[model samples]
Target: MTAFCATGAFAADYVPGELVVRIPPGGNVQAIHDAWGTQTLEQLSLRSYVVTPPAGVNVEDCDQWLDADSNVESADPNWITESPEAKSAIIIVAIGSSTTQYTDQGAFARIGLAEAHQYSTGQGVRIALLDTGIDPSHPVFQGKLIAGYDFVDDDADPSEIATGVDEDGDGLTDEGFGHGTMVAGVIAASVPDAEILPIRVLDDEGSGTLASLIRGIDYAVSRGAQIINMSVGLAFESEPLENAVSDAEDAGALLVAAAGNENTPTEIYPASFGQVLSVTALDSNDVKASFSSYNEEVDVAAPGDGIYSTYPGGTYARGSGTSFAAPFVTGAAALLFSAGTPGEPGDLAQSLTDSVVVVDSLAGNAPFAGNLGQGRLDVESALTGYLAEQATSVDGAFRPYGVQFFASPNPFRGATTIRLSTPAGTTMPHELEIYSLQGRRVRTIRSDSSDRGAWEWNGLDDRGRHVSAGVYLIRSNAGSLQSVGRLVHIR
Candidate 1:
């Protein structure tokens, strides 16, 4: 391996002990570390490693040394920065002892979630909240939260702590103490039953390193998170950060991030990544929030101005920013996932983009129209539109809300593959039973023990007799959940 000097901030000289580096695929990270006379600290992913150099070495020299080897992608200092906690303007309404109703306010009805709630409550969906720790004891999250890890404190208690120290040196102390709890509240409002997994990537001051963010992503994916809500982002580009986002997407988890509140189109990590669904903020008037960042990467918009949601200490507060806007989409996606919606991540994302109602107030306004994404989120429209599409299929069957098992090449010449989309890391006994339209069992097939399993059918009855060319019903039974789909067989 040969090192290639990377330009920019890496060119600066600084005393360094630890660094984050990405090694080439299938290469020995340990051997590479030994060649550089460094000790391995941890492995972020299969190809990403954290190592520290021997005494008297600077970060700039280490970059140059690692760049000389061809097995390295890029090596940079273990850079630390606050999660994009930059909100353009925040109107914080203190929570007193008088509030009881949190989601009954205008934000719920404005986004059309009140109507959407009748259909799905985001049950059985696991959403990973990557931000400041959450207060799980809050009544709104009484039975909604799952145990999550705290990367900042390296403990199991992922609860928000109050520290008056300005860890980010932003001239503020504990600015992000209750940020994660608020984000979780917005999601609950839309998908009240979705399981909230609070992964604390940011500290009490709302500050953390890129390495910590990467660790949070790794943890979320391993735990089978269907949707990851990152109400945080980084300003500058980092290869390690980008690679982590790609890893999450490849694992079949949907990534959602908040567009910066800097009021500029400047891109932010994870949010800018192609695999992530970036969200911008909007106000109750159905207009773009004055502070939401405008960019080509923005995929959807949600209410962010003066949004009312759950706060720490078992109270409700009104806050505003793109940070709060993102959970609405997260919750909406969770609702679909829990309903056993079948489609790739991109397919699900397209459903949302198509369901957005174009606003006349913002259309042709050039700036807002071009950058505010399709339009503000309408959960009722998105869910109704998705199910409506399913009902109009070839078989005219309704597969409403349940487990999803569908087959391709329905009009099969001889055989077809049935794909099952289950919750991540789920392994259970299931069988695919094919039957004639007249209710005679044709063939029974079993799926592999994995979240995503597949099986094939050969148009034959249990006696190995070729059934007459006709339509067949394929039903997938997994414990208490079952889904029915149609198939056409021709002789």
Candidate 2:
């Protein structure tokens, strides 16, 4: 277990995408697939940059194990080990990595000052992060945050996010900085009932590689993060990032991502993936943010620009961008999951987007109507559906009175059949568009006829490929008539 000081970024730049481990690792014949790594320990590294060992194939006797972080953590069963024949596997979660709340007398939230006191009030859940480790001495997080893994080099304490000491020789985080600290506050604040994981995915200077994201996501899922909010994004997609998302999905966790401030329809990775919930920004008027991207590739929209949230030092900020919107949904999701909802992340996404309030016409207001999604988020309505079950009106011809869609399989598996109909006899030749949860148009099962009827996706996309396990849509159209029905693709 040599204290390897990793200075450079991961050999591979991380982007979010599908994780596929075509082959299994050695010794662990049951090791079917790793949501975060393909090669298991060979690909996984601890904060100390130490190689992890395969499950049941313990490296306690190996020299690398001896050199790893003295407090290095491992998944309970180690997802990198075997397959219990689970369609959706279990994973560890790193909620609020450290909820010690060291800043406010041992129990204080770091952001969302307006709701600061309510941060951990009654979450009954946890807030996990991966940034400047926590100050266990802080009262708010002390005795909270439960447990976490320190990925920083040479540091026995996983709580230290920025240390003036480069004890491990890693060139990063020589000084104390708070990146994940702010992120944790956004998700955990105004909800004292939740916990914080502080997984430490990023180092000081707001920079991280795919390796850390993978390890952090894996650790969080394993620890049980039902709502994993990522207030971050990358330019391109990476295999490791994709695997991280997959792992979280397997654990039935929602990966809430920031839609980016690029202000263009072209998307950012991870948030642009099919499994994620891409949140855009909408002002108080329910208008799309100028910086928010718009295109057919966006799923949902939320209050982003000029939004406020928690930061380090117990202070609040008026931070803007889709980064904060991701948390609105993340926190709401936590509320739902803790209250017995948000079952599968893939489905949670559809629930949030399809039922969102259609105010000010997000499509008409934004530069690109397709990317802005369904206007703004209505927390109570979104979670419990105050208006979901009741739409404005379907009228004759199944025309979209405001913004309502149709789908199949209330709780279906792969290839759930879907059929949409108009108000008896509406004829339209519009294409049937199928968009993934992340807003990417995956399969367009065209309805060549100009009449109402049924069309089968066969659970396959236009690319002739079978998508992952999650929620999907079968958008119907017949000239002026349109409807969006929800579907599920199971393995």
Candidate 3:
């Protein structure tokens, strides 16, 4: 059996000549190994084992034996994986925190920090950041970053390493070197009081195997992290990786991940997992970034373009990608955690969704809105949106409002179906009107006695021309009773 380690930043892909075997629960581990002529290299858990073939045997032979074994639930080669290469596109125009180079605009201001800070500074909340490691001495993360395991070097030092090579071929070598630091900086800037648990899964070359990522997830859960931010991702799917994410969510961690920077719809692991809150990126114009990958799994959008944050050596630099956007939500989740919000990750996700002010341009016209999770991340609104939702009226009045109105694909890109439901057989004058947030009536979506039916809005106004991207209010009236719901339209 051979132990593998990369010597340089650009080391040969070390495909471990071993297998990760997950035995059925309560299955006899000794019996299974005895039948396969393999010896356990490490016991990840009672049911999960990393095993290697005998000295003279072929690895494929051992795999065949395990595949045919009824006692083995799942077994496969311990595949070598790497961080999403697109993050190498992170363009750093200037470095260091010097007043001349640094923009005064803080990362917090982009996401409405003034209002969010009033509610929570993420005090007492712990967020686990899984990335290439972090610089321990960065001022922004001085007391907040708690070092976890270094899966690469297998040591206590989780410092970010640079291979001095453009691992992702973006013309910049070691572009991912201080990636973790930047991500941590974003979280710190958003929630200065929140605790950060840094986990080093990727190596100096911005590559890590599935095992490392899974280990990081397990550690994040065990360390009592309320939020786990995965700024890195792998393109291929791995069962073990998916299971680890699920386990983290089950253990009460709000898992957030980058949606990848390939600018394609292809899903990246962990982020693509159902348990994770996949985040996309937006530019200064509040428009979807051309490089931000979009898909159905995207949960929320955040400012990722030209984001300035802390870097190594007591400096700061600007970077961009979904990798940066994810931490915004992570910081936001830390606020929810610090507030002791009731419910699991799903509830937290829903709260963030409801809070978004809505980037209407992401509606039906662009393919990044409805299909991509919910909407943009409104940190302040998220902190207060839940309470506001519970109260039907601003004064907390419980009026008997009769009709129920809802807009499907609320943050729609092209068109949406609005449904107005009322008590059956108690028909009154039914009307559905679409109005801009500015109080101007755009169109009358419906005006009939039909209590329950679906009406389509082709993203146009009464003038029959497509309206500009913005929030639209749907008002439903039956007799003297009225109900209102919000619909977001995007170009």
lDDT of 2 by residue, 119-148 (tens): 113245665554545544444454557677
The parts of candidate 2 lying over 4 Å away from their true place are 1-42, 45-123, 130-144, 154-176, 359-364, 386-491
The candidate that achieves the highest TM-score relative to the unseen native structure: 1
Q: Write the per-residue lDDT of candidate 1 for residues 10-85, one digit (tens) a residue.
A: 3432214667777777777777766767778877767777788656777546655675677677666666545455
- Backbone clashes under 3 angstroms, per model: 9, 89, 12
Arranged by TM-score, best first: 1, 3, 2
lDDT of each: 0.74, 0.49, 0.71
Estimate, for each residue in 297-379, the C-alpha lDDT of model 3 and write its tens digit.
88788888888888888889888878888999998887765543346789888888878857756444276556455777889
Reference-based lDDT, residue 286, model 3: 70
TM-score, predicted candidate 3 vs. hidden true structure: 0.71
